[model samples]
Target: IVLAPVSLAAEDPLPSWRDGPGKAAIVEFVARVTRQDSAGYVEPHERIATFDNDGTLWSEQPLYFQAYYALDRIRDMAADHPEWKEREPYRSALAGDVKGLAAQGKGPVVEMLVAAHANVTTEAFTRSVAHWLATARHPRTGRLFTEMVYQPMLELLEYLRANDFKVFIVSGGGIDFIRVFSHERYGVPPEQVVGTTGGARFELRDGIPVVVKTGDISLIDDKAGKPVGIWRHIGRRPIFAAGNSDGDLQMLQYTTVARNEDDTTPRLGLIVHHTDGEREFEYDRESAVGRLDRALDMAPEQGWLVVDMKRDWRRVFPVAGS
Candidate 1:
């Protein structure tokens, strides 16, 4: 695929990045990077920015959408494994009782993930994601999964790229899941996505060492694990980070912490507050999936810019066919 050259024109590619503080901060950060005399003059190669995928780039509620996909896949695969009907989370998930399933918390979620995501070759898993996204519609929005991506966040991605920032998706969603469409949807190529990964093995199916199926569950990219994933995967601390939930706080923190490297710029951290229930669910203090409690309380102390989606974003989802 012929990728378009990154555009750095002053049109504000991310019209959704807001006009006030949130917008100002991003603009200032970009200006600093471009100014040769500025303390933040970062060479293009060192201009790395990391973004959380689910709540950061798009809505993660009513539950991690990827979990929903896993549940759906589990249900489909359960026909072959009738034992899943009696399994804890799978049973609850198949029964359409998400609240009950979540009550079991991260452990049950992990079990469901292993059951559904494991044992599938990387190629097969990618094919499954492509198939599901092409056909599945979000329960609330009734739009294709890819269509549910935030217009503003998508614009922010393009904006960063335009400024010579090497953008990556440091999401809790499956790396393979986001990689399938990250290029087409967000313009971040497959290699630029970092997320929870299932273990796979090299198999010579036809004399090729292609990654094959495995039953191993590796790291999950969320909460404190976000920093761990970043360190292990990207191997570079990001100078800019954005996320929308407590799950993303560590990631933002990891980015904003002062760096000792001479070439690295001081970081910019922005949090997306989901304050618009009219357009999207807006329960920060109580939501389970993308909880924003701690991030809200520490925003002022941390000097992090909090974006109230209801007030900041002029448009939410991308317009049809956009």
Candidate 2:
């Protein structure tokens, strides 16, 4: 009796990824940590993977899609606060001048949106975001912002989850904003997302309990804050971390850098390098949004795998309707 040969292609976990060092590295790391007989085996409960959302999992070009959301919100609010029509940032946002609004820096743009969210019921804010995501299309791609998420990363997330890894999103974008679509887009639930958070005030609104955004940020989950957010939200060091910019340097270090001499558990740190200008926008070290500078410089020293977008991903955005 003879048996038919098995197909390796049918078992390829990350089909969107090209056959290259970056994809091979991720597959190898997952195999090593999940194999119970391997020395690098990690318990399912301890397998935490944190990813930076914007450039790491999705496209962050022209401006962060969140910034675009905020800009649109500013325009919507202009009717309520007519003074905003003349206000600096508001004026630019009202004009749909993405470059002008981005020039104000991500911080100010973040603050602008949070301010709009201020004093509103959490339910209301969530609805507004949901509405925007449903209707708003990327300025360049003409696809909905959520449609721009990286297919390779989505496959990576699925691969990790199949191995029993708990994935969390740690980003500089608004926590409340990301929560609106995190589960639907990345299969990551709201609770697993940790990001720049605004202070909230709990109060009774017309016989019901409500939480209102106070326009006061409690944390900015980027750069050094990333590690702190991970600790505060997850309560444990991540075994794997992925990011795309200098903002992720500290988190990468926190994940891969050994705490002490005896800490020898296998760890992985990955950086998504935007090298494909034809399929995607390319900027690093010098670009304002999602700048990948020092992190790129130190990736080699840190044993981090820097994935070149042009070379590693067979496709960037998910195919429509897939």
Candidate 3:
């Protein structure tokens, strides 16, 4: 089987990243890494950058991707198990009444996650993820799940790569789930993605090595887990980081700490603040899913760039259908 070659050329593509502090920081970092005579000049292999998923790179409005996966799983598995039609959360999910389920609160949602996520073999889980991503559409927008990616972030990714940065997604979302479409959508291949993962075991299927998913859960990648996941998966510390909300606090902290160790090569951290209610949901300090309280408080003190989505993004989605 032949895979398309990954791109490793081109100039910094996001020169228009704006003239604010964020832009200046990024430009300075690039200059340092690229200068042959600079003490900060980093070899290409050392240029690691990590980004959090969810609201950081896409509109995680309405709900998270895992929630959507759970709903769809219930819907798909319901036909075989007729009892789900009468089950509490499953019933609501089957009826397309997510609000009703949410009204019942986290209990129902957790039940759904346990039922849909646990006890499956890793291969089965991957297959399930593939099936859902292939078929699912955003309820409100009616766009494919992969198509919901933020255009500006996509540009930033390309821009970073042009500057010799090796971009990786250290997200709380499932690794395989995001990997399914990230290569096509974000130009980030599956091998570079790291996220919260379920259990898996190796087996011999027809004398060939195969990975099976265990019903057991391993890690929940969120908040403090972000840095842990990055450390475990990528090994090398990132010189640049970007994320949204308090879930990304530890990641930003880790990146900033690296900057202090060596002043020669500047480290970069940016936070995406949800401020566009018309284009996407906007909330701070109190939203259940993507609460940004800690990040907002830390942004000023930490010198982390807080990106105002409304003010910064000229375009949100990719030309509606481009």
Best by TM-score: 2
- Model 3 off-target regions past 4 Å? 1-12, 15-19, 78-124, 206-208, 258-264
Model 3 weakest 10-residue run by lDDT:
102-111
Provide the overall lDDT of each model, using Cα atoms, as 2-decimal numbers.
0.80, 0.91, 0.76
Off by over 4 Å in 1: 1-10, 104-111, 206-208, 259-264
Instruction: List pairs with backbone clashes in candidate 2.
Output: none
Give model 2's TM-score versus the native structure: 0.95
Model 2 C-alpha lDDT per residue in residues 169-276, reported as the tens digit of each score: 999999999999999999999999999988999999888999999998898898999999999999999999999999999999999999899899899999999999
Q: Write the per-residue lDDT of candidate 1 for residues 165-277, one digit (tens) a residue.
A: 99988887777788999999999999999887667777687685678656556878888988998888789888888888888889988888665665456678888888999
**How does candidate 3 score on lDDT?**
0.76
Candidate 3's displacement at residue 125, Å, is 3.7
Query: How do the candidates rank by lDDT, highest first?
Result: 2, 1, 3
Number of backbone-clashing residue pairs for each candidate, in the order shown = 0, 0, 4
**Cα lDDT for residue 97, candidate 3:** 79
Task: For model 1, give the 10-residue run with minimal summed lDDT.
Answer: 102-111
Cα lDDT tens digits, model 3, 1-322, are 9897867444445543555666666667778877889888888888899999888888776777666887767777777889888878778778877666645443345446655665455566667778887788898889877778888889889877977889999887777678877888888999999887667778787796777655444666677888888888888778889998788899888887645534556677899888888877787677766778978898888888888878777767776655
The all-Cα superposition gives candidate 3 an RMSD in Å to the true structure of 5.6
Which candidate number would show the highest lDDT if scored against the true structure?
Answer: 2
